[model samples]
Every structure is written in structure tokens, then in C-alpha cells.
Target: MSISDQIERLATAKANIAAAIESKGVDVPEGASISDMAALVVKIPVFTEEEVFLAAHPVGSYFKTASKGDPGEIYGGRWELDPSLGAFRWRRIE
Candidate 1:
């Protein structure tokens, strides 16, 4: 296929995947996981240990972490920031 045709196909696929996830009432942060996408499954992307800390401690001048190495680790493949608790909390991907 031509480069333009390939790009169009990929874009269409992405939109379809996103629409399918929304229909199932799921939210994908950043982007949907690749493995289960074709199945229209809500596969939440698992973050690396270091990435968790970085997210919790966003590097903007105004952002600060309560302490070092304290983004709270992801459990069961998903991590959510709980403002009420002021910490990262484990949440189910499915």
C-alpha cells in the first residue's frame, strides 16, 4: 500500500479501538494497550516501576513529591492517583 494509504488505515484502526473502549466504559491513559486491542478488550497499560514515581512526582516547578521514590507502585497492573488520600492507589484494570 502507498504511505498515505497505510497511514489512513492505522488512523482508522486507532479510532475504532478507542470507540470500542469507550463503549465498554473504559478510560485509557496515554494510549490503549496493544496486545488486547484487536479483541476490543480494555487492557490497561502497565507502567514501569520508575515511571510510577515520575508520574507521582511530576517535574513541573510547581509539582513536588511528598518524598523520593514515592509514586506508590502499581498493583495488579493499574495505579491511580487518589487526591483524597494524596497517594497512589491500586485499581483494577478490568
Candidate 2:
């Protein structure tokens, strides 16, 4: 799915679920939707090879090996630039 589709899914989730997002003991202002949260968050899927590594190291491995390891046929995969990571992250609406 596209970013737009993911954003829409997040928006739909926001409509269905209510959770408080706070920083420094203050809640973020309204109009900040789940899509905004999703923008701030990125999900890196666990592939078969990475599964063992992830099981051993729950935190995550280096991007180079992680990207190359057992990435079986990514159907409808896309990438988004993560400014903090200074790299493109794979994104797919699972």
C-alpha cells in the first residue's frame, strides 16, 4: 500500500481507537491524528533470516544486513525517507 493508503488506515484507526499521546507530561494537541503518529513511526518487517537475529537481538541489526537478509519477494513494497536514520525505510501496509 501507498503512504496515502497507510495514512488513511491510520486515520481510520484514529476514528475507531482513542489513545492518549503525551510528551513531557503534556498531551499533544488535537488535530494531530494517527497518520501523524505513523509518520513519526516506521515499521520494518521481520523477514525469515532476520527473524532469528531479531529473536536473539530484539532491538534490530544494522540496516545493510537487515536490508539484504532474506527479503523474500516484497509484494507492493515502497520506501520512505527517514530523516533521522538518513536512509530510506521499507514500508508496506500489512
Candidate 3:
């Protein structure tokens, strides 16, 4: 498919996912949680951890401590993932 076609499909898929999630009564952050926006990223041929972080951290600034990690450091913005970590990292976008 053409690039435009791919983009359109992605956009549609994202919208559908958003609607589905909204239907679930979950408050989705505008630019956080690729999974929250899985409708779009899941359709892509490939995605990266960084992209996930970007998707989850739309504010592009600020940081929060990961619930589980070395018991310190690795703030939310650092983008570290560990089974011990519990809190979801995110950015507040206006």
C-alpha cells in the first residue's frame, strides 16, 4: 500500500482503539501509553521501546519515580522497565 494509505489505516485503527478504550471507561491520556493507543501502534509493522515511551510521555518533559526499580533513580522519564516496577509512567499534556 502507499504511504498515505498506510497512514490513513493507522489513523483509523488508532481512532477505533481509542473509541474501544473509551467505551471501557478507562481514562486514556492524550499522548501516553502506546497500549492505550494500541489501535494505532499495534497496526504498524514495527515499533520501538522509545516510541512506546514517546507515546506514553506526550508532555515531552518532567519525570516520575518508577514504583519498583533499584529502590531509587530510573525516574519515569528515564524509560526503564522492570517486573518489580508497578506504576505506569506518563506525561500530562494540556
- Highest TM-score scorer: 3
Q: Give the per-residue lDDT of model 2 (tens digit) for 1-94.
A: 9999998997777754334334223343467666665543333233575455344433322222235322224322233322335343433222
Question: What C-alpha root-mean-square deviation, in Å, does candidate 3 show against the real structure?
Answer: 15.4
Ranking by lDDT: 3, 1, 2
Q: Enumerate residue pairs that collide in model 3.
A: 32-56, 33-56
Instruction: List runs of model 2 lying over 4 Å from the truth.
Output: 19-29, 32-94
What lDDT score belongs to each candidate, Candidate 1 first?
0.51, 0.43, 0.52
- Sorted on TM-score, highest at the top, how do the candidates line up? 3, 1, 2
Off by over 4 Å in 3: 36-94
Candidate 2's displacement at residue 12, Å, is 0.5
Error of 2 at 19 (Å): 9.5
Cα-based TM-score, every candidate: 0.34, 0.22, 0.35
- Weakest ten-residue segment in model 2 by summed lDDT: 74-83
As for TM-score, the candidate ahead, 1 or 3, is 3
* lDDT, candidate 1, 35-56, per-residue tens: 5465546354556766665555
In lDDT terms, which candidate is top?
3
Worst 10 residues of 3 by lDDT: 68-77
Candidate 2's error at 22, in angstroms? 17
